[model samples]
Target: MRGADKLVSDSLATAKRIIDPDTPVLARFDSAFYSANVAKAVRAAGVHYSVTLPQNAAVKKAIAHIPAEAWRGINYPQAIYDDETGRWISDAQVAEIDFTAFSSKAQEEQLAGRLVVRRIPELNTTKLAAAQGQLFDTFRYHAFFTTVEQSVLDTVAADKVHRQHAVVEQVFADLKAGPLAHMPSGRFYANAAWLVIAAISHNLLRAAGSVAGGKLVNARTVSLRQKLVNIPARIAHRARKLILHLPTHWKWATAFDRLWHNTLSPPQLATP
Candidate 1:
Protein backbone atom coordinates (compact mmCIF):
# COMPACT_ATOMS: atom_id res chain seq x y z
CA MET A 1 0.00 0.00 0.00
CA ARG A 2 2.91 2.33 0.62
CA GLY A 3 4.66 1.94 -2.74
CA ALA A 4 2.81 4.31 -5.08
CA ASP A 5 4.58 2.94 -8.17
CA LYS A 6 3.53 -0.64 -7.46
CA LEU A 7 0.02 0.50 -6.56
CA VAL A 8 -0.24 2.42 -9.83
CA SER A 9 0.87 -0.62 -11.84
CA ASP A 10 -1.50 -3.00 -10.04
CA SER A 11 -4.40 -0.56 -10.28
CA LEU A 12 -3.77 -0.02 -13.98
CA ALA A 13 -3.68 -3.79 -14.57
CA THR A 14 -7.00 -4.19 -12.72
CA ALA A 15 -8.49 -1.32 -14.72
CA LYS A 16 -7.34 -2.92 -18.00
CA ARG A 17 -9.25 -6.07 -17.10
CA ILE A 18 -12.51 -4.17 -16.52
CA ILE A 19 -12.22 -1.46 -19.16
CA ASP A 20 -12.34 -2.02 -22.90
CA PRO A 21 -8.97 -2.33 -24.61
CA ASP A 22 -9.76 0.45 -27.09
CA THR A 23 -10.87 2.88 -24.43
CA PRO A 24 -8.35 5.50 -23.40
CA VAL A 25 -7.44 5.79 -19.73
CA LEU A 26 -6.12 8.84 -17.91
CA ALA A 27 -4.75 8.73 -14.36
CA ARG A 28 -4.52 11.81 -12.16
CA PHE A 29 -2.45 12.12 -9.03
CA ASP A 30 -1.46 14.81 -6.56
CA SER A 31 2.08 16.10 -6.03
CA ALA A 32 2.66 13.53 -3.28
CA PHE A 33 2.50 10.70 -5.85
CA TYR A 34 4.73 12.37 -8.42
CA SER A 35 7.93 10.44 -9.05
CA ALA A 36 10.05 8.95 -11.83
CA ASN A 37 9.00 5.38 -10.94
CA VAL A 38 5.31 6.33 -10.83
CA ALA A 39 5.51 8.05 -14.21
CA LYS A 40 7.41 5.08 -15.65
CA ALA A 41 4.74 2.68 -14.42
CA VAL A 42 1.99 4.80 -15.99
CA ARG A 43 3.89 5.05 -19.30
CA ALA A 44 4.54 1.29 -19.36
CA ALA A 45 0.81 0.75 -18.92
CA GLY A 46 0.24 2.81 -22.12
CA VAL A 47 -2.12 5.27 -20.43
CA HIS A 48 -1.93 9.04 -20.07
CA TYR A 49 -1.36 10.57 -16.64
CA SER A 50 -1.66 14.06 -15.15
CA VAL A 51 0.33 14.74 -12.02
CA THR A 52 0.69 17.91 -9.96
CA LEU A 53 4.36 18.86 -10.20
CA PRO A 54 6.06 20.67 -7.35
CA GLN A 55 7.57 23.95 -8.52
CA ASN A 56 11.18 23.09 -7.89
CA ALA A 57 14.26 24.78 -9.38
CA ALA A 58 14.16 22.84 -12.67
CA VAL A 59 10.42 23.42 -13.10
CA LYS A 60 10.85 27.12 -12.42
CA LYS A 61 13.58 27.21 -15.05
CA ALA A 62 11.28 25.60 -17.63
CA ILE A 63 8.45 27.95 -16.67
CA ALA A 64 10.76 30.90 -17.10
CA HIS A 65 11.43 29.85 -20.71
CA ILE A 66 7.76 30.25 -21.66
CA PRO A 67 7.23 33.28 -23.90
CA ALA A 68 4.98 36.15 -22.83
CA GLU A 69 2.61 35.69 -25.81
CA ALA A 70 2.18 31.99 -25.01
CA TRP A 71 0.04 32.74 -21.98
CA ARG A 72 -3.66 32.77 -22.91
CA GLY A 73 -6.40 34.23 -20.73
CA ILE A 74 -8.98 31.86 -19.25
CA ASN A 75 -11.98 32.50 -17.00
CA TYR A 76 -13.56 29.85 -14.84
CA PRO A 77 -17.33 29.52 -15.15
CA GLN A 78 -17.47 29.49 -11.36
CA ALA A 79 -14.84 31.48 -9.50
CA ILE A 80 -12.52 29.42 -7.32
CA TYR A 81 -11.75 30.75 -3.84
CA ASP A 82 -8.06 30.71 -3.07
CA ASP A 83 -7.48 29.70 0.55
CA GLU A 84 -3.85 30.87 0.53
CA THR A 85 -4.47 34.35 -0.83
CA GLY A 86 -8.03 34.67 0.55
CA ARG A 87 -9.36 35.88 -2.79
CA TRP A 88 -12.13 34.84 -5.22
CA ILE A 89 -10.30 34.33 -8.51
CA SER A 90 -12.44 34.16 -11.67
CA ASP A 91 -9.73 34.53 -14.32
CA ALA A 92 -6.15 33.45 -14.93
CA GLN A 93 -3.64 32.84 -17.74
CA VAL A 94 -2.53 29.37 -18.85
CA ALA A 95 0.40 28.21 -20.98
CA GLU A 96 2.22 25.02 -21.84
CA ILE A 97 5.83 24.16 -22.70
CA ASP A 98 7.61 21.01 -23.87
CA PHE A 99 9.42 19.69 -20.82
CA THR A 100 11.13 16.63 -19.41
CA ALA A 101 10.51 15.31 -15.88
CA PHE A 102 12.81 13.48 -13.47
CA SER A 103 15.88 14.82 -15.23
CA SER A 104 18.05 13.56 -12.39
CA LYS A 105 16.97 10.00 -13.12
CA ALA A 106 18.68 7.69 -15.66
CA GLN A 107 18.38 8.79 -19.29
CA GLU A 108 15.89 6.02 -20.10
CA GLU A 109 13.89 6.68 -16.95
CA GLN A 110 13.35 10.37 -17.70
CA LEU A 111 9.73 11.01 -18.79
CA ALA A 112 8.88 13.51 -21.51
CA GLY A 113 5.72 15.58 -21.11
CA ARG A 114 4.27 19.08 -21.27
CA LEU A 115 4.42 21.48 -18.37
CA VAL A 116 1.02 23.15 -18.28
CA VAL A 117 1.10 26.23 -16.08
CA ARG A 118 -1.55 28.57 -14.77
CA ARG A 119 -0.83 31.91 -13.17
CA ILE A 120 -3.17 34.04 -11.06
CA PRO A 121 -2.46 37.67 -10.19
CA GLU A 122 -0.89 37.95 -6.75
CA LEU A 123 -3.45 39.85 -4.67
CA ASN A 124 -1.29 39.95 -1.51
CA THR A 125 0.90 42.99 -2.12
CA THR A 126 2.76 42.58 1.17
CA LYS A 127 4.07 39.12 0.31
CA LEU A 128 4.48 39.93 -3.39
CA ALA A 129 6.66 42.94 -2.61
CA ALA A 130 8.95 40.78 -0.47
CA ALA A 131 9.06 37.97 -3.08
CA GLN A 132 9.54 40.14 -6.21
CA GLY A 133 10.44 43.75 -6.95
CA GLN A 134 7.70 46.37 -7.59
CA LEU A 135 8.88 46.81 -11.21
CA PHE A 136 7.07 43.60 -12.32
CA ASP A 137 3.49 42.48 -11.57
CA THR A 138 3.62 39.36 -9.39
CA PHE A 139 1.54 36.27 -10.03
CA ARG A 140 1.23 32.90 -8.28
CA TYR A 141 1.87 29.95 -10.57
CA HIS A 142 0.39 26.45 -10.51
CA ALA A 143 1.79 23.79 -12.80
CA PHE A 144 1.22 20.11 -13.61
CA PHE A 145 2.87 17.43 -15.76
CA THR A 146 0.65 15.70 -18.29
CA THR A 147 1.20 13.16 -21.10
CA VAL A 148 -2.14 13.94 -22.72
CA GLU A 149 -1.54 15.10 -26.31
CA GLN A 150 -2.06 18.75 -27.20
CA SER A 151 -4.14 17.81 -30.23
CA VAL A 152 -6.65 15.95 -28.10
CA LEU A 153 -6.95 18.64 -25.46
CA ASP A 154 -5.39 22.10 -25.42
CA THR A 155 -3.73 23.59 -22.35
CA VAL A 156 -6.98 25.00 -20.96
CA ALA A 157 -8.88 21.71 -21.32
CA ALA A 158 -6.01 19.76 -19.83
CA ASP A 159 -5.86 22.17 -16.89
CA LYS A 160 -9.61 21.72 -16.35
CA VAL A 161 -9.25 17.93 -16.43
CA HIS A 162 -6.33 18.07 -14.02
CA ARG A 163 -8.34 20.21 -11.60
CA GLN A 164 -11.04 17.51 -11.57
CA HIS A 165 -8.63 15.52 -9.34
CA ALA A 166 -10.14 17.51 -6.45
CA VAL A 167 -13.17 15.22 -6.77
CA VAL A 168 -11.04 12.38 -5.37
CA GLU A 169 -10.33 14.52 -2.30
CA GLN A 170 -14.07 14.77 -1.76
CA VAL A 171 -14.25 10.96 -1.76
CA PHE A 172 -11.51 10.79 0.87
CA ALA A 173 -13.40 13.39 2.93
CA ASP A 174 -16.58 11.29 2.68
CA LEU A 175 -14.72 8.17 3.85
CA LYS A 176 -13.21 10.02 6.83
CA ALA A 177 -16.61 11.42 7.77
CA GLY A 178 -18.29 8.01 7.86
CA PRO A 179 -16.97 4.44 8.37
CA LEU A 180 -13.32 5.56 8.34
CA ALA A 181 -13.90 7.88 11.30
CA HIS A 182 -11.89 5.54 13.52
CA MET A 183 -9.61 2.53 13.11
CA PRO A 184 -11.30 -0.52 14.60
CA SER A 185 -8.03 -2.30 15.45
CA GLY A 186 -4.32 -1.60 15.87
CA ARG A 187 -3.24 -4.37 13.47
CA PHE A 188 -2.43 -3.30 9.87
CA TYR A 189 -4.39 -6.11 8.16
CA ALA A 190 -7.38 -5.40 10.34
CA ASN A 191 -7.26 -1.76 9.27
CA ALA A 192 -6.89 -2.83 5.63
CA ALA A 193 -9.93 -5.11 5.85
CA TRP A 194 -11.89 -2.31 7.46
CA LEU A 195 -10.93 -0.03 4.59
CA VAL A 196 -12.08 -2.64 2.03
CA ILE A 197 -15.46 -3.03 3.72
CA ALA A 198 -15.85 0.72 3.96
CA ALA A 199 -15.13 1.07 0.24
CA ILE A 200 -17.67 -1.63 -0.64
CA SER A 201 -20.33 -0.01 1.56
CA HIS A 202 -19.60 3.37 -0.02
CA ASN A 203 -19.99 1.93 -3.53
CA LEU A 204 -23.26 0.24 -2.57
CA LEU A 205 -24.66 3.46 -1.15
CA ARG A 206 -23.64 5.37 -4.29
CA ALA A 207 -25.31 2.72 -6.48
CA ALA A 208 -28.47 2.87 -4.39
CA GLY A 209 -28.53 6.64 -4.70
CA SER A 210 -28.01 6.39 -8.48
CA VAL A 211 -30.93 3.96 -8.80
CA ALA A 212 -33.13 6.20 -6.65
CA GLY A 213 -32.28 9.25 -8.85
CA GLY A 214 -33.33 12.85 -8.00
CA LYS A 215 -31.29 14.78 -5.43
CA LEU A 216 -30.32 11.47 -3.83
CA VAL A 217 -28.22 10.64 -6.91
CA ASN A 218 -25.53 13.09 -5.81
CA ALA A 219 -26.36 13.10 -2.09
CA ARG A 220 -23.55 12.38 0.37
CA THR A 221 -23.40 8.98 2.05
CA VAL A 222 -24.62 10.48 5.34
CA SER A 223 -27.61 12.13 3.67
CA LEU A 224 -28.37 9.02 1.62
CA ARG A 225 -28.38 6.81 4.74
CA GLN A 226 -30.53 9.28 6.63
CA LYS A 227 -33.11 9.68 3.85
CA LEU A 228 -33.34 6.06 2.71
CA VAL A 229 -31.81 3.48 5.08
CA ASN A 230 -32.73 4.93 8.47
CA ILE A 231 -36.53 4.96 8.20
CA PRO A 232 -39.29 4.42 10.77
CA ALA A 233 -41.62 1.71 9.53
CA ARG A 234 -43.73 -1.20 10.78
CA ILE A 235 -43.83 -4.63 9.13
CA ALA A 236 -46.88 -6.93 9.59
CA HIS A 237 -48.24 -10.13 8.06
CA ARG A 238 -51.83 -9.72 6.87
CA ALA A 239 -53.74 -12.20 4.68
CA ARG A 240 -50.56 -14.18 3.84
CA LYS A 241 -48.99 -11.00 2.45
CA LEU A 242 -46.24 -8.94 4.09
CA ILE A 243 -47.26 -5.30 4.41
CA LEU A 244 -44.96 -2.47 5.53
CA HIS A 245 -46.45 0.68 6.95
CA LEU A 246 -44.35 3.85 6.93
CA PRO A 247 -44.98 6.98 8.90
CA THR A 248 -47.50 9.29 7.23
CA HIS A 249 -46.27 12.50 5.59
CA TRP A 250 -42.73 11.28 5.79
CA LYS A 251 -40.14 13.23 3.83
CA TRP A 252 -38.23 11.46 1.00
CA ALA A 253 -40.93 8.76 0.74
CA THR A 254 -41.13 9.21 -3.01
CA ALA A 255 -37.34 8.76 -3.35
CA PHE A 256 -37.55 5.52 -1.32
CA ASP A 257 -40.42 4.27 -3.49
CA ARG A 258 -38.43 5.02 -6.63
CA LEU A 259 -35.45 3.06 -5.31
CA TRP A 260 -37.68 0.12 -4.34
CA HIS A 261 -39.48 0.02 -7.70
CA ASN A 262 -36.30 0.44 -9.69
CA THR A 263 -34.57 -2.37 -7.78
CA LEU A 264 -37.39 -4.95 -7.28
CA SER A 265 -39.79 -4.22 -10.16
CA PRO A 266 -40.23 -7.22 -12.50
CA PRO A 267 -38.45 -7.09 -15.80
CA GLN A 268 -40.50 -6.93 -19.00
CA LEU A 269 -40.21 -9.94 -21.32
CA ALA A 270 -39.56 -9.49 -25.02
CA THR A 271 -42.59 -10.18 -27.29
CA PRO A 272 -42.30 -13.21 -29.61
Candidate 2:
Protein backbone atom coordinates (compact mmCIF):
# COMPACT_ATOMS: atom_id res chain seq x y z
CA MET A 1 0.00 0.00 0.00
CA ARG A 2 1.21 3.56 -0.70
CA GLY A 3 2.33 5.27 2.50
CA ALA A 4 3.89 8.57 3.66
CA ASP A 5 2.05 11.88 4.04
CA LYS A 6 -0.14 11.29 0.97
CA LEU A 7 -3.78 12.23 1.44
CA VAL A 8 -6.44 9.59 2.16
CA SER A 9 -7.85 10.18 -1.35
CA ASP A 10 -4.71 8.66 -2.85
CA SER A 11 -5.00 5.63 -0.59
CA LEU A 12 -8.69 5.29 -1.41
CA ALA A 13 -8.03 5.53 -5.17
CA THR A 14 -5.41 2.84 -4.93
CA ALA A 15 -7.77 0.72 -2.89
CA LYS A 16 -10.53 1.31 -5.49
CA ARG A 17 -8.51 -0.49 -8.17
CA ILE A 18 -8.68 -3.86 -6.39
CA ILE A 19 -11.09 -3.74 -3.46
CA ASP A 20 -14.73 -4.70 -4.05
CA PRO A 21 -17.79 -4.48 -1.81
CA ASP A 22 -17.58 -8.18 -1.00
CA THR A 23 -14.15 -7.97 0.60
CA PRO A 24 -14.10 -9.24 4.17
CA VAL A 25 -12.27 -7.72 7.10
CA LEU A 26 -9.07 -5.93 6.10
CA ALA A 27 -6.75 -6.13 9.13
CA ARG A 28 -4.62 -3.01 8.83
CA PHE A 29 -1.83 -2.47 11.38
CA ASP A 30 -0.38 0.99 11.19
CA SER A 31 0.80 3.30 13.99
CA ALA A 32 0.13 6.73 12.53
CA PHE A 33 -2.24 6.16 9.59
CA TYR A 34 -5.47 4.97 11.27
CA SER A 35 -8.00 7.57 12.40
CA ALA A 36 -11.60 8.63 11.86
CA ASN A 37 -10.56 10.50 8.70
CA VAL A 38 -8.53 7.62 7.30
CA ALA A 39 -11.27 5.26 8.39
CA LYS A 40 -13.53 7.07 5.93
CA ALA A 41 -11.26 6.07 3.04
CA VAL A 42 -11.33 2.42 4.05
CA ARG A 43 -15.10 2.59 4.56
CA ALA A 44 -15.45 3.76 0.97
CA ALA A 45 -14.23 0.27 0.00
CA GLY A 46 -17.11 -1.17 2.05
CA VAL A 47 -14.97 -3.53 4.09
CA HIS A 48 -14.37 -4.02 7.82
CA TYR A 49 -10.89 -3.08 9.06
CA SER A 50 -9.08 -2.60 12.37
CA VAL A 51 -5.89 -0.63 12.92
CA THR A 52 -3.75 0.78 15.71
CA LEU A 53 -4.79 4.24 16.78
CA PRO A 54 -2.16 6.95 17.02
CA GLN A 55 -1.29 8.08 20.56
CA ASN A 56 -2.76 11.56 20.19
CA ALA A 57 -5.04 13.65 22.36
CA ALA A 58 -8.21 12.45 20.70
CA VAL A 59 -7.41 8.78 21.19
CA LYS A 60 -6.14 9.45 24.68
CA LYS A 61 -9.37 11.23 25.52
CA ALA A 62 -11.36 8.30 24.23
CA ILE A 63 -9.23 5.97 26.31
CA ALA A 64 -9.85 8.07 29.39
CA HIS A 65 -13.56 7.47 29.06
CA ILE A 66 -13.12 3.80 29.89
CA PRO A 67 -13.33 3.02 33.63
CA ALA A 68 -10.28 1.71 35.50
CA GLU A 69 -12.28 -1.36 36.59
CA ALA A 70 -12.43 -2.49 32.98
CA TRP A 71 -8.63 -2.31 32.77
CA ARG A 72 -8.04 -4.25 36.05
CA GLY A 73 -5.77 -7.18 35.19
CA ILE A 74 -5.08 -6.21 31.56
CA ASN A 75 -1.58 -5.41 30.41
CA TYR A 76 -0.39 -4.45 26.94
CA PRO A 77 2.94 -6.07 25.96
CA GLN A 78 4.50 -7.99 28.85
CA ALA A 79 7.47 -6.07 30.18
CA ILE A 80 9.48 -6.55 33.37
CA TYR A 81 10.35 -3.57 35.48
CA ASP A 82 13.88 -2.22 35.11
CA ASP A 83 15.47 -1.70 38.51
CA GLU A 84 18.22 0.58 37.28
CA THR A 85 15.96 3.05 35.50
CA GLY A 86 12.66 2.17 37.18
CA ARG A 87 10.80 1.73 33.89
CA TRP A 88 8.66 -0.99 32.32
CA ILE A 89 9.84 -2.36 28.98
CA SER A 90 9.42 -4.38 25.75
CA ASP A 91 6.42 -6.18 27.26
CA ALA A 92 2.88 -5.07 27.87
CA GLN A 93 -0.72 -6.24 28.47
CA VAL A 94 -3.91 -4.72 27.09
CA ALA A 95 -7.73 -4.74 26.79
CA GLU A 96 -10.29 -3.47 24.28
CA ILE A 97 -13.86 -2.09 24.35
CA ASP A 98 -15.80 -1.03 21.26
CA PHE A 99 -17.31 2.44 21.07
CA THR A 100 -21.02 2.92 20.42
CA ALA A 101 -21.07 2.76 16.60
CA PHE A 102 -19.36 5.87 15.19
CA SER A 103 -19.23 5.47 11.41
CA SER A 104 -21.77 3.25 9.68
CA LYS A 105 -21.91 -0.55 10.07
CA ALA A 106 -19.22 -1.46 7.51
CA GLN A 107 -17.07 1.42 8.75
CA GLU A 108 -17.45 0.82 12.48
CA GLU A 109 -15.28 2.77 14.94
CA GLN A 110 -14.20 1.56 18.39
CA LEU A 111 -12.26 2.73 21.43
CA ALA A 112 -10.08 0.77 23.88
CA GLY A 113 -8.15 1.48 27.03
CA ARG A 114 -5.00 -0.62 27.30
CA LEU A 115 -2.67 -1.07 30.27
CA VAL A 116 0.58 -0.68 28.39
CA VAL A 117 3.60 -2.51 29.90
CA ARG A 118 6.54 -0.62 28.45
CA ARG A 119 10.34 -0.82 28.66
CA ILE A 120 13.07 1.59 29.54
CA PRO A 121 15.79 0.09 27.39
CA GLU A 122 18.82 2.16 28.27
CA LEU A 123 21.60 -0.10 27.14
CA ASN A 124 24.95 0.81 28.63
CA THR A 125 27.88 -0.83 26.92
CA THR A 126 31.46 0.03 26.17
CA LYS A 127 33.70 -0.82 23.21
CA LEU A 128 36.85 -0.53 25.30
CA ALA A 129 37.41 -1.80 28.83
CA ALA A 130 38.40 1.66 30.06
CA ALA A 131 35.22 3.21 28.71
CA GLN A 132 32.90 0.82 30.52
CA GLY A 133 32.22 3.35 33.26
CA GLN A 134 31.37 6.08 30.75
CA LEU A 135 28.65 4.28 28.89
CA PHE A 136 25.99 5.76 26.68
CA ASP A 137 22.54 4.31 27.21
CA THR A 138 19.35 3.98 25.23
CA PHE A 139 15.88 3.75 26.74
CA ARG A 140 12.91 2.08 25.07
CA TYR A 141 9.29 1.45 26.04
CA HIS A 142 7.21 -1.56 25.03
CA ALA A 143 3.40 -1.37 25.10
CA PHE A 144 0.17 -2.58 23.52
CA PHE A 145 -3.14 -0.85 22.66
CA THR A 146 -6.54 -2.27 21.84
CA THR A 147 -10.19 -1.59 20.97
CA VAL A 148 -11.68 -5.04 21.04
CA GLU A 149 -14.03 -5.73 24.07
CA GLN A 150 -12.97 -6.02 27.74
CA SER A 151 -14.91 -9.28 28.17
CA VAL A 152 -12.73 -10.98 25.54
CA LEU A 153 -9.22 -9.79 26.36
CA ASP A 154 -7.78 -13.28 25.95
CA THR A 155 -9.20 -13.64 22.47
CA VAL A 156 -7.21 -13.07 19.25
CA ALA A 157 -8.31 -9.56 18.31
CA ALA A 158 -7.11 -7.96 21.52
CA ASP A 159 -3.41 -8.69 21.08
CA LYS A 160 -3.00 -10.00 17.54
CA VAL A 161 -2.34 -6.68 15.87
CA HIS A 162 0.52 -5.80 18.19
CA ARG A 163 2.17 -9.12 17.44
CA GLN A 164 1.96 -8.60 13.69
CA HIS A 165 4.16 -5.53 13.31
CA ALA A 166 6.75 -7.94 11.99
CA VAL A 167 4.70 -8.43 8.84
CA VAL A 168 5.18 -4.79 7.87
CA GLU A 169 8.86 -5.20 8.74
CA GLN A 170 8.96 -8.04 6.22
CA VAL A 171 7.78 -5.63 3.51
CA PHE A 172 10.82 -3.49 4.28
CA ALA A 173 12.83 -6.69 4.11
CA ASP A 174 11.56 -7.12 0.54
CA LEU A 175 12.35 -3.48 -0.27
CA LYS A 176 15.91 -3.82 1.03
CA ALA A 177 16.35 -7.06 -0.88
CA GLY A 178 15.32 -5.03 -3.95
CA PRO A 179 15.68 -1.70 -5.74
CA LEU A 180 15.06 0.56 -2.75
CA ALA A 181 18.38 -0.46 -1.19
CA HIS A 182 20.47 2.14 -2.98
CA MET A 183 20.24 5.76 -4.10
CA PRO A 184 19.98 6.13 -7.89
CA SER A 185 22.27 8.63 -9.57
CA GLY A 186 23.96 10.15 -12.65
CA ARG A 187 21.47 11.42 -15.26
CA PHE A 188 17.76 11.32 -14.51
CA TYR A 189 17.13 8.87 -17.37
CA ALA A 190 19.84 6.47 -16.25
CA ASN A 191 18.49 6.30 -12.70
CA ALA A 192 14.99 5.86 -14.02
CA ALA A 193 16.13 3.00 -16.23
CA TRP A 194 17.88 1.34 -13.31
CA LEU A 195 14.80 1.69 -11.13
CA VAL A 196 12.62 0.29 -13.89
CA ILE A 197 14.83 -2.78 -14.22
CA ALA A 198 14.93 -3.38 -10.47
CA ALA A 199 11.19 -2.91 -10.10
CA ILE A 200 10.50 -5.38 -12.90
CA SER A 201 12.85 -7.90 -11.31
CA HIS A 202 11.11 -7.51 -7.97
CA ASN A 203 7.60 -7.89 -9.43
CA LEU A 204 8.60 -10.86 -11.57
CA LEU A 205 10.12 -12.51 -8.55
CA ARG A 206 6.92 -12.03 -6.51
CA ALA A 207 4.69 -13.13 -9.39
CA ALA A 208 6.75 -16.26 -9.97
CA GLY A 209 6.67 -17.19 -6.30
CA SER A 210 3.05 -16.45 -5.38
CA VAL A 211 0.77 -16.42 -8.44
CA ALA A 212 2.59 -18.61 -11.00
CA GLY A 213 2.26 -22.15 -9.64
CA GLY A 214 -1.09 -21.92 -7.82
CA LYS A 215 0.35 -21.88 -4.29
CA LEU A 216 2.98 -19.45 -3.06
CA VAL A 217 6.35 -21.22 -2.72
CA ASN A 218 9.44 -20.29 -0.78
CA ALA A 219 11.97 -21.30 -3.47
CA ARG A 220 11.43 -18.12 -5.47
CA THR A 221 13.16 -17.25 -8.75
CA VAL A 222 15.50 -14.75 -7.13
CA SER A 223 17.03 -17.49 -5.01
CA LEU A 224 16.83 -19.93 -7.92
CA ARG A 225 18.98 -17.74 -10.21
CA GLN A 226 21.50 -17.07 -7.47
CA LYS A 227 22.02 -20.79 -7.01
CA LEU A 228 21.87 -22.02 -10.64
CA VAL A 229 23.43 -19.18 -12.65
CA ASN A 230 26.91 -19.75 -11.25
CA ILE A 231 27.41 -23.24 -12.78
CA PRO A 232 30.74 -23.39 -14.64
CA ALA A 233 30.85 -24.94 -18.15
CA ARG A 234 33.40 -25.29 -20.93
CA ILE A 235 32.79 -24.43 -24.60
CA ALA A 236 34.26 -27.08 -26.99
CA HIS A 237 34.10 -28.44 -30.51
CA ARG A 238 32.19 -31.72 -30.87
CA ALA A 239 30.55 -33.57 -33.81
CA ARG A 240 29.21 -30.16 -34.80
CA LYS A 241 31.18 -26.89 -34.95
CA LEU A 242 30.68 -25.92 -31.32
CA ILE A 243 29.20 -27.42 -28.14
CA LEU A 244 28.79 -26.45 -24.51
CA HIS A 245 29.76 -28.93 -21.75
CA LEU A 246 26.94 -28.66 -19.24
CA PRO A 247 26.71 -30.08 -15.72
CA THR A 248 25.99 -33.79 -15.25
CA HIS A 249 22.20 -33.27 -14.90
CA TRP A 250 20.74 -29.77 -14.96
CA LYS A 251 17.64 -29.96 -12.70
CA TRP A 252 16.66 -26.32 -13.33
CA ALA A 253 17.16 -26.46 -17.09
CA THR A 254 13.42 -26.94 -17.73
CA ALA A 255 12.37 -24.15 -15.38
CA PHE A 256 15.01 -21.86 -16.87
CA ASP A 257 13.74 -22.56 -20.36
CA ARG A 258 10.18 -21.80 -19.34
CA LEU A 259 11.30 -18.54 -17.77
CA TRP A 260 13.21 -17.50 -20.90
CA HIS A 261 10.28 -18.31 -23.20
CA ASN A 262 7.82 -16.39 -21.10
CA THR A 263 10.10 -13.36 -20.93
CA LEU A 264 11.40 -13.15 -24.53
CA SER A 265 8.38 -14.39 -26.50
CA PRO A 266 6.36 -11.67 -28.25
CA PRO A 267 2.95 -10.72 -26.98
CA GLN A 268 0.09 -12.78 -28.53
CA LEU A 269 -1.84 -10.58 -30.95
CA ALA A 270 -5.52 -10.29 -30.14
CA THR A 271 -7.92 -11.49 -32.83
CA PRO A 272 -10.20 -8.83 -34.31
lDDT of 1 at 53: 89
Q: How accurate is candidate 1 locally (lDDT)?
A: 0.92
lDDT of 2 by residue, 26-56 (tens): 4355666555555556556454445554455
lDDT values for all models: 0.92, 0.51
**Candidate 2 Cα outliers beyond 4 Å, as residue runs:** 1-8, 25-27, 32-40, 43-49, 53-154, 157-168, 186-196, 206-225, 230-272
Q: What is candidate 2's CA lDDT for residue 123?
A: 46
So what's the TM-score on candidate 1?
0.75
Name the candidate that leads on lDDT. 1
- Residue-by-residue lDDT tens digits, candidate 1, 22-55: 9999999999988988888999999998999898
Indicate the TM-score of model 2.
0.45
